[model samples]
Target: MDAERGGGEAPAAPRDGEGRFRRRAFLVGGGLGVLGLGGAALVAGPGGVRSAYTRVVCGSTPEPPPGGTAGRRQGTLEGRRVIVAMPRAARDTVPVVVMLPEPPGDARAPYDLYAVDRYLAASPGGFAIASVDGWPSADIVGALLPHLEAGGLDVRRIGLLGWAAGGAEALRLAAQLGSGVVRAVAATSPDVTAARAPLRELVDIPVWLGCGERDDRAPQTETMLKGLKALGATTEGGISSGCQDTAYRRRVLPEQLAFFARHL
Candidate 1:
């Protein structure tokens, strides 16, 4: 489970915070006993993924896409029933984050936010933090298309933050959404070469890609700069510091939030 990128001679887990993050990333949610609340799903078309995103686990249970578990509605993606959590608080045109989890059965769950939230727990400039679940990274965002618009969200300020599956999901949406999503951040995200043909579509928006040097799953640090370059995106790529684990050096998530705040 929390191995090095590319699955080579991975190093041992450090006793520092990063090590804890990796361990948490892979198995946090697995240990939890989740209670199904009859989720609400919104299905979309046939989506694609390059290399899958890193699998990290959070202690969160699967719920509907609106960000809460109270009243569940039914949605579909590719005709598959989808469930989303209803947003907890009342928001008027709130900036939202669309997150996709790694494959459900994959070693890594979609809990990358457990680590991301540690750094970005509070919203910047009163921006409310919200994430929607999808069949994959792409499916989670399908709800945002029109099915869930009544939430009164400000689409102009929507920022996408995806880990492995979610990153690809966000990228897919970026290819289609045009300027709908103001800013994007991909953490240990896949490259365009592995994405669909639309990967070349230009975003012209501010995007950031981050990966650990040891995270071989995708471009550890520099691949995103190259990929976004082709897409004509105003983009930057770099390694994240402050990671306690040497195998998967971490990019400071706060920097990611700063990028979102600055651009979105």
Candidate 2:
């Protein structure tokens, strides 16, 4: 099943002062810990520090527009629902980032939880966001790429982003698809043990892995980062203030989107 709707105009880019503030806050909050750079991990206790960090990084979370906002499409592929958000300023054929939401999160999570549509709108050289419900699989991608390409999205350059279990799935799928197909991947609070792909498969693909400093899975994320670096993979990430929840994911989403924009 497939349906398309017109989305509202893309939001304006952040002002110079706001952009500078966001960059400064990100650095001060220790959010720049790129994995391969040997940067120190950032840790924050609950309450004030975490709350302030969240506010600075995420700003205000906007409510998703009713039905479909501008530059958005909805469809079902391989029996799973999908939501594709494009930038109003997109070219005839734009690259796409495929989002695999955590378990219990559906296609709407990217828009509802992280306000990805707004982010997409602000991206300079805009790309499309394809958020999928349930686990990501080759079968789904096999069907999804064609569907998106038919709609004028570029299928050659692809990126992946995921949260929690979905994060692990993203890594595994990136390896499965290989670097030729996947340009980059970003994951938040991923369950590394669940990603069984051999490390060598990821060497050519840029991987960004992040998790909340207080999350129990932070150690696993750190370990995964180290392993990826050792394998010569282009990887970046670090621990932030919150735990494995929506707020933390939202805090790191901008960086993830930036990573996608840079490499995809």
Candidate 3:
């Protein structure tokens, strides 16, 4: 099956090395703090650690509510459960952001974990959000794009967003689909090591890679950023002061959305 045609079997779930890293980072940093080892002092003592940590862990701003104007649709595609969120006052044909959830998370993860619907409502431009169950294969997204277009989305302008393992999948799919098909890609706490595509393939595509400063994957994310730059790929995002947790993702999501809005 050709990935470009979106007619291939889904790949097995990629191994999750980041899960171990998330656990370790939590235990070592948040755990020590919880154990009365000056966690409060570190957070309250303030040398900007508190501010940065709070921003990363507890987002500096409040997430918006999904206004009545927004619409949500759910169904199955290629045997995978799918969920799509359409922004407020969306046009008959809107661009879309394909969300690839972390391994073990289903189509609902984007909303349940990130409140993506609310973010979409708050975005300056209108776009739809499409998420699928399990690890996303190029075939799954490849099928998804046209499906969305059939449902009134602008398939020509597309973006991919994912977290952790899903992040890697997003990168792989973007490369496989080629720059002509994908406009931009954004990832949080991605396991780039798991992505099988060559960075050179991403030369013309705009990419955004972000992770928590305290996340164990930070170094790898930085390395990926440098590599993308070396390839002259337009890239954004770097280490922020938080660990590999939900808070960090929420804090970074707006920027990711903005990046997509600019390019897509």
What would the per-residue lDDT of candidate 1 be over residues 177-217, giving only the tens digit for each residue?
76655455444444334434243554566776766544454
Residue 171 alpha-carbon offset, candidate 1, angstroms: 1.0
Winning model by lDDT? 3
Winner on TM-score between 2 and 3 is 3
Q: After superposition, how far is residue 67 of candidate 1 from its true place, in Å?
A: 22
Query: Which pairs of residues collide in model 3?
Result: 213-240
In candidate 2, stretches whose alpha carbon ends up further than 4 angstroms from where it belongs are 1-70, 136-138, 194-197
Task: Report lDDT (Cα) of residue 257, candidate 2.
Answer: 77
Give the whole-model CA lDDT for all candidates, comma-separated. Answer: 0.46, 0.74, 0.76
| After superposition, candidate 3 runs with Cα above 4 Å error | 1-69, 194-197
All candidates: TM-score: 0.52, 0.71, 0.73
Using TM-score, rank the candidates from best to worst: 3, 2, 1
- Worst ten in a row by lDDT for model 1: 42-51
- Candidate 3, residues 1-264, lDDT tens digits: the string is 455577776666546886665464455456446544435535444444445455545455445554633468988876877788998787567888898878875888888777888887788767788987765444565576777778888878789888998888888888888788789988888876624445888888899999887788888888888988987889999888777777778878888888988998
For model 3, give the 10-residue run with minimal summed lDDT: 41-50
